[model samples]
Target: MTATTIPTKTIYAGTGRRKASIARVRLIPGSGKLTINGLPGESYLQYSPNYIRITYGPLHTLGLDKEYDILVNAQGGGLTGQADAIRLGVARALCNVNPEHRGALKAEGHLTRDSRVKERRKYGLRKARKAPQFSKR
Candidate 1:
């Protein structure tokens, strides 16, 4: 008896961060579909067109929107931060699939991680840098 071996699909992975959010993304060769935290991206993103568009920026830039499937696990931060993190993760995974894509992705600014986070509150201050109001007696 002869045994047949099945081929396994290869997956490319990337990690991205924005503010306090982090996203781990995987790319597999398949029909265009995006899932986040085990839910369809559109549903997970609450059908927000803006978010959907932002999340697909890298794919759209490379004209490969319908060529791959994306899976993402994102945590921390707010909705906007998560969306941006996913975008960066997708762009990185695309680059991993093809290093040549780096130039394009870089030019599109998807490779840059936004580092702006909430400022930490300082001691004896109302806010990060604001001070309590004072009046001379």
Candidate 2:
């Protein structure tokens, strides 16, 4: 008699960054569940609908929101930046699962990493470009 073995589902990985935030994302074949830094996505994001929407934008765009589970580890920056970073990470992971998703994700701008960050303060500036109070005696 011959033995048959079943293949396990594959896991896809991707990294994304926005401002000072970084996210490591994983996509696996499962229900539409999301976890961030060992916590449920909603709880971690403070139950904000906008954060949830931003984090799931890529999957929604490709109509795969309920097809796979997402696992994310994010750090640094604020909530918004972390959400955007997770979005890009998810988009990249989708592309990894199927290269054909690239065009769709790209068209939706999910594949683009936001590069905007806070400007550094100069020596003579109060903050970034803000000047100190002028004293004209």
Candidate 3:
């Protein structure tokens, strides 16, 4: 008996992060290449390993068999934060692909947003939490 296979619905999503000033981005399967917000001559190869690892999470964990075009737009973060944020976004997109994976992705904490960010400084302080030097003798 010949068995028939069912087709899975493809889902498209976007993610972004801010680190210092640079933004990180990630997109789903595309035409054998990655695109980033229309910045010509830009390649995914230029990004760090973390960015690569997270952006390609669905490919590695869920398998790269998928073939779809994803566009990413990110800004206002350093490469590290951007990379992490991108991972968060991709993980989210994957969940969209198949809601069943939510448990696994959530267990891994990939779906959670990073709350750490730069804190604004207050008056009479050198930094956000730091205060002026005080000496009493």
Candidate 4:
């Protein structure tokens, strides 16, 4: 009988939300690589510099952009919201990797989750805040 051993390394996880989007992130020690929902980060993000930049904000601020691989499973909202959520998740995972990172990530504002979301449309209104043209008749 032969026994096989699997190498174990520390894995950090975090979850973030923005608008209707949610991102579950995992940080693994390796060359910088990003995979989202089984797709390459760049391809999934449509190679947008803005989005790519946003997702790497925390890592860049901490000078660890090339020190870890990011794997994210994101769902719901649009790409913008998903991008923001990923940023927050990455920041949080970094914190889990090292509590001391909280201070720096917080200072960079990457640890903050954007809480703004579309307001639910009211039953009596055409939209969340808009009502049918004022009938001043």
TM-score of 2: 0.93
lDDT (Cα atoms) of all candidates against the true structure:
0.91, 0.91, 0.57, 0.91
Best by TM-score: 2
For candidate 4, the 10 contiguous residues with the lowest summed lDDT are 1-10
Candidate 3 residue-wise lDDT, 3-117, digit = tens: 1223553345645454443333334445524455564213543655656666556546655435644455666555566566666766666666668877877777777777767
lDDT of 4 by residue, 21-54 (tens): 9999999889999999999999999999999999
Q: Is candidate 2 or candidate 4 better by lDDT?
A: 4
Clashes of 4: 0
- Kindly list the per-residue Cα lDDT of model 2 for residues 17-79, writing each as its tens digit: 999999999888889999999999999999999999999999999899899899999999999
Question: What order do you get sorting by TM-score, best first?
Answer: 2, 4, 1, 3
How close is every model to the real structure, measured as TM-score?
A: 0.91, 0.93, 0.67, 0.92
Model 4 clash pairs are none
After superposing candidate 1, which stretches have Cα over 4 Å from the reference? 1-6
Error of 1 at 71 (Å): 0.4
Candidate 2 has its poorest 10 consecutive residues by lDDT at: 1-10
Off by over 4 Å in 4: 1-6
Q: lDDT score, residue 29, model 4?
A: 88
What local lDDT score does residue 25 receive in model 3, on the 0 to 100 scale? Answer: 39
Best by lDDT: 4
